[model samples]
Target chain A: MPKSNLDLINDCDSFPYDTFPSQQSAFTGYYTFLLPNDARPHGLLTSATVQSMPWTSDFRIDHSTKTVHLLPASHNPADLASSCTSALSNLITKAIQTNTFPILHGKHSEPYPILGAPKGPISIERFARSLFGLTARGAHLTVYTRTVHGLSIWVPRRSPTLFTYPHCLDTTVAGGVTTGEDPFTCIVREAAEEASLPEELVRTHARSCGVLSYMGLRDEARGGGGGEQGLVTPDLIYVFDLEVGEEVRLEPGDDEVEAFYLWDVETVRRGLAEGGFKTNSAVVMVDFLMRHGVVRPETEGDYVEIAMRMHRRLPFPVSARQVL
Target chain B: MPKSNLDLINDCDSFPYDTFPSQQSAFTGYYTFLLPNDARPHGLLTSATVQSMPWTSDFRIDHSTKTVHLLPASHNPADLASSCTSALSNLITKAIQTNTFPILHGKHSEPYPILGAPKGPISIERFARSLFGLTARGAHLTVYTRTVHGLSIWVPRRSPTLFTYPHCLDTTVAGGVTTGEDPFTCIVREAAEEASLPEELVRTHARSCGVLSYMGLRDEARGGGGGEQGLVTPDLIYVFDLEVGEEVRLEPGDDEVEAFYLWDVETVRRGLAEGGFKTNSAVVMVDFLMRHGVVRPETEGDYVEIAMRMHRRLPFPVSARQVL
Candidate 1:
């Protein structure tokens, strides 16, 4: 049976239609989350529904100003950092208790990678990621090759005992954009750590393929924290396409990945249709198929919708006055 | 003397800060240009500013609804197509009168590649491109080679007698994204036409390296129309990085390009600093250097700003309701 576009996206992690208010709300106020690479808002944030979450206690919403204050204006960098850290620690402890320890619990020793914040070591960034309170930018590499049979994708099976969708399929190389590191640096580091590939080879072969931004209500049992309330996970993964020769092989360089396999495009499509791959990874693969012209509007009835869904609209203000 | 990032972008074409109204204005309304392959608004358009332009006679703005209707709802696609054709023909005629005929006046037989438009031929796409009224999406290929001494970029010199930016330095191969064509297919077509590279070789060597989206106001003497009003040229060029062997030699295949040269990275940077290359091409080169780690953020004070500027925020609605 031929799989439809809806079938492919059926199990993919997606935000509920009513998760975010269609219009700005007076009660919740705007400035719910931080904008990546920019300090502006294109539209007002109306996550009024999420204001009552336990992790959001540190943030104060002012109905009078219709704004979200991340600590008071009188708070210095030190005070702000302390508040963020304290809030994040409580959330992380609770999350870890239910989901087990994270596979890569990074040192909270770096300054949070805020767009316009002061630079210093702050571990709250890691906590922010677990809570999905903040949008964590990262680079994902989809390494593939063309053979006589046609195109095949290289996928990694995550370690079974680790946190976060353990035993699921992932892109060839993926990791978070840490506080001090850029997308390229992160991709290179992850390629070496997650997959035992030579640095020189990875550098030459990998190519940046824009960003895949998505907002989803992640499951608590799937290593995402915040209990059944479900954290709003806003992620921006800088997609990279790398074409390697047939001789190149990938071995699991770290414990994050359990094994590596090269699956043909047919197998990949079927996996995506059957919801076998991790939701995010499936989105990435869908993007790959669209770019390569494998999936066309004629073949996929919801082609435009699928293509447009790859990026979520982030509200960015035109002026710096909105920056808190 | 080395040039700073500001120096590099000083003369580059860009939108005026005031072109778009401040914050979803009801009087002017908001129509965001799209970030490619996504339904996100990367930037907004205030038709209030454009409503007074010479060629925008057909576009009617409804302040109450906050929408800029391309044509009256009563007008059919055929009627709208005729209006677009009439506007484009006049603009093209005026443009050609001054700068010799265009090297390649593409067939108006293709549908206007509006995201939500019907799939049929419409000549107005060319007019939209020349007027820079709506954003035009295209794919650009930056072919380079890795040598023992580091990297060298392939540059093409535009023909002195050409219509647009005559004799200016360009990427190894560059072209527009025709209505129905995807980036990969466009690149393949352009590679053969501009650089005379074999189709098979281009397919194997080229790698998709994200997109460089910028909004610029171009000059009247150049191919850009809209006269003194200076159309806001919103462009999203899908950047391709093709690594070729040191042995391959490129010859200009089409009359659009006068000559081809392979300059090392240092020479490319110096040319860019001195404004020897076209403004957009300069931006693209800077992006290439940044991704390859040839440019460091610590060394470059405007690193973050430069990276973010490559992709301007365009305003795109969630639904497919904005087709003209």
Candidate 2:
């Protein structure tokens, strides 16, 4: 039996935060990572990771409160950034040397921002984000063209050599939002680098269709990076829709994407139902179906629940301005 | 000073459920309305309303737990609907006759579904919905046309004589979703009845853009409806987008709207910033701007927060089936 559209959403947003008790229990035993002078938690640390990791003076783990507090070397924005970055860098190096976590082996030099952090210029290496359950922001673009029959989407298969979710179906152009880069700019850059899409074509046609936030749990079934299971993953994906002309073509520019396939609506639905697409990409496709009127209340029983779950109110702070 | 885009959103989603203590206090002292066999609350009632209303065998108000459990006349669907309808309708009639809640005076004969109720074809008169703090479902359509200066929306002004939100700007076509009516069908019907839009045009051009769910508080500042203030209003608006040609003209099919104006993007923004649009309509319009890329993260610092708040999770059940 194939999975329903709601099931696909649950595959990505698997954390149980529906009930008041469940929400309380979801983070009860986890070690909270907080900035100095802030009551709101920025990240969650598992007991196993907290026990195995080496401690530096920059971080003070209060066992009583189960909190890991970031004690900055200085309050200045640049100094805070430098101190935190060096401390995390040294920890990642030690983990790699001891072969503790294979996920750190695929670390890139790119810095991913802690989105809602109060202090300025706080970021860590891209791959090590999951170690402390911080919210990861990314941009995903769903490119489609109207055909005589219906709409067809440009889908890509991930390169098998990639470390995470390799050889799975993906959005036309998708990438992480690096530090200081907005979502739109990130998508444009990823489109050019990964899909060989023309800059002018993307800029002119792509529509910002809002965002999807979910609390994801990285378990072993997700495959790729060999890390401990049940790492709390909160994600905020900025979704974009690009309606291209039938004449336009997409080619893989790098080894990240294996190939591009232009699949019709039915094919896309079948792929989603069969669990062939990557979890988060499947969620994006489900959102596309809902937005385009392909999936509706009349046909789908879980329409309202699916829409609400896709945009779950993430527990962490999302904006530096503290509007919430 | 003009309000920023995020301020416009906060006008509708003003309830502070961001913190644990705030969420706990939001419904702490309120009376819970539950079905006989269910533990989850279907509605919330204020103590004042409970004291003034007449009670029958159908409902048992437990002062100990601040709960009003509906003891259905029978468990059958038809019987349950009849019992609830009669119980609420009689209460509404007495309230209107004695001049208790002026909101009941504006009631229509149409029935509104109790969207996640466990038993029966449960529905009640539309006006009585706020008294019990039930989730209200509606359909809103945003009609726009592309021109030389970008997108121009067809905005409507409510009739000054209307019962609620008089003389305020509204979406192109908006109305409540009556019982047994799906959102798409409701929108098509509303478009024809409210905006004089052709049935064929609406059926063909209108695209289901998705939904916006918010927890709204009905207060005195909202105006026109003479109801008790601070009514818990959880709304699920099925939003649609209709792109029409420039030649199309909209006239008032009924007295709900006085006239229609084709406001350019700047005018719409100014109207929103100046607090001209009706509260919920302004929210729907802001959603339109976000979907259309008029509001970008590059310009709005509260980008992520606005998107998340627009889709706050309702506490009660929403769908008939137990998908959640």
Candidate 3:
């Protein structure tokens, strides 16, 4: 039997991350996450506190609470990104020294600003790496086709040469929401790039579903890099479902995706149980199945638990960020 | 301004009620609730502890931890109901003494058994009152009509003579799931009784969307009677949406409902802000609006908080009960 969603999130507790209040000059509602002193450190931290980092004096770390805050609350995203570029590059280089890394693709863009809504472009690599110590946001699209038999999901397999979760099953279209881009725009671009789908078809058929959020330690074994094991990953995934008819054909539009597979719900469930899909994609699929009534409380013993886990309920003010 | 969902549930914390493990003799997985010493009395308790209650020799309450337990592990729902009849009647009579109460409606049937999947019948009143200290489950239906102007929800003005939330707005149809009954059947029955809708139309139009669960103190101000304030109410509300055509008309099928109002989204939002709807129905409407794109993150500052609040995330294992 496949492990329940509750089991997957058993260790993803949020209490360990102490919170830092917004600084006097920055946006008022947003909060930043700080690793507690007792937490195991990944390679990212220079010392036990955020203030000890020698790169730039743009952050504050409270020793009493062990909380970390970005300084000069009005600091521009571009200037912040510019300041962190060398430090971020060094960290990525250190990671590559321990593992084979793939060259980054797509335009480096700014995602919705975490604290304030600002239009600024940051490298996608840095955003994913949480170089600024903020949660990252992404858009994941689940493309499915319904026939007389039942529902079948369009699954993509990552290229073997990619650095992250390569050759594993993934959602039909998934991409990080860049620093300055809207979720809808990001998903539309990804749909065309990853699946060779027309913009019109994606815009016409796509529905904005709810979101999936999670905070957890990065899986170091997956080639994210060894000393990177305890790097905190806080993500807010905006989910969408696109329905395609039998007449529509999907081919890999980019080298990042190796191939596509249309698998029935049962088959998908089995594969998910056997760990055939990427972790985030599996979470999205499980949520999709639950929402469509393909899975029910009677059939699944942990249905309530699974449903609650998808919400994540991160304490950060994600909606207050004008960027989304 | 309409109160945000977070504001509405600000004081509705899920503590004060201590958990009681299932007795060794009865079911293995079922649990019950007991009020802690510091909490206010709900008037339902015969004594400060569950052990002191005379009716069921099956229950045990530990003073040190303030934990309660049902002793007979194998006690069936029917047997449990039978054992608590007199005690439950006492609570009901006490309630009646304080306020005018309406006669309970619907078939007094047993719902899905909690621990083991067995068929049995328990009175709707007892189940709603949770005489056995089990979570009560019910189904609520939202019937709406879509036209050129926009979508209009069929809101029922509850009868002034009714005991609970008198004259307040309610869903198109809502009813408690009785023992030995299924959610679908209960909703269908409620649709016909509360709205005079044809059974065929109801069975065909109603779609099982999802569920909303909450755990809080039952309102003592309502006709459920004073001192009823502290009684813990853990509920799993199965939600459904029924689509009706413009030509269809809705009338109160019974005196439980006084009138019907077809209100557009804006009007309903105003009414919610003005405190025109019952509490639970307000939650259901907020969820429906969010799901249907009527409420967007851009327009609603508390969108994330509202969405998270709808899940409730009660600690009790609602799924352990065989009943849906």
Winner by DockQ: 2
Candidate 3: residue A204 Cα off by (Å) = 4.8
TM-score of each: 0.68, 0.95, 0.72
Give a tens-digit lDDT track for model 1, residues B1-324. Answer: 766654565345355332211333221334443322333332344453334334344445455554444443334555654554455455445444443223214233233454443323234445444333455666778888899998988898889887657788887887777765777788899999889889998788677655556666555544432343344566667677788989988899989888888999888877777677776777777867766656654356555445545654333321244321
| Weakest 10 consecutive residues of candidate 1 chain A by summed lDDT | A18-27
The candidate that wins on lDDT is 2
lDDT of each: 0.59, 0.83, 0.58
**Better-scoring candidate (TM-score), 2 or 3:** 2
Pairs with backbone N, CA or C atoms under 3 Å apart (clashes), candidate 2: none
Instruction: Give per-residue lDDT, candidate 3, residue A221.
Output: 54
**Error at A167, model 2, angstroms:** 2.4
Residue B230, candidate 1: Cα error in Å is 5.9
Candidate with top TM-score is 2
Mind giving the per-residue lDDT tens digits that candidate 2 earns over B1-324?
888877877777766574522245567667888876667777778887788766766779999989988775544655676677677677666666677776676445578988776665678778888788888888999999999989999999999998677899999999899988889899999999999999999999899878888887777876647657777778898899999989999999998999999999999999999989888899899889988989877787888888888887777788766543
Error of 1 at B263 (Å): 1.5
lDDT of 1 by residue, A96-211 (tens): 54443342153333334543333232344455453434555667889999899888889888899876678888888998777667777788888999998878887786776556
- How well docked is model 3, in DockQ terms? 0.17
- Compute the TM-score of each model's chain A versus the native chain A and list the values: 0.73, 0.94, 0.74
C-alpha positional error of residue B162 in candidate 3 after TM-score superposition, expressed in Å: 2.0
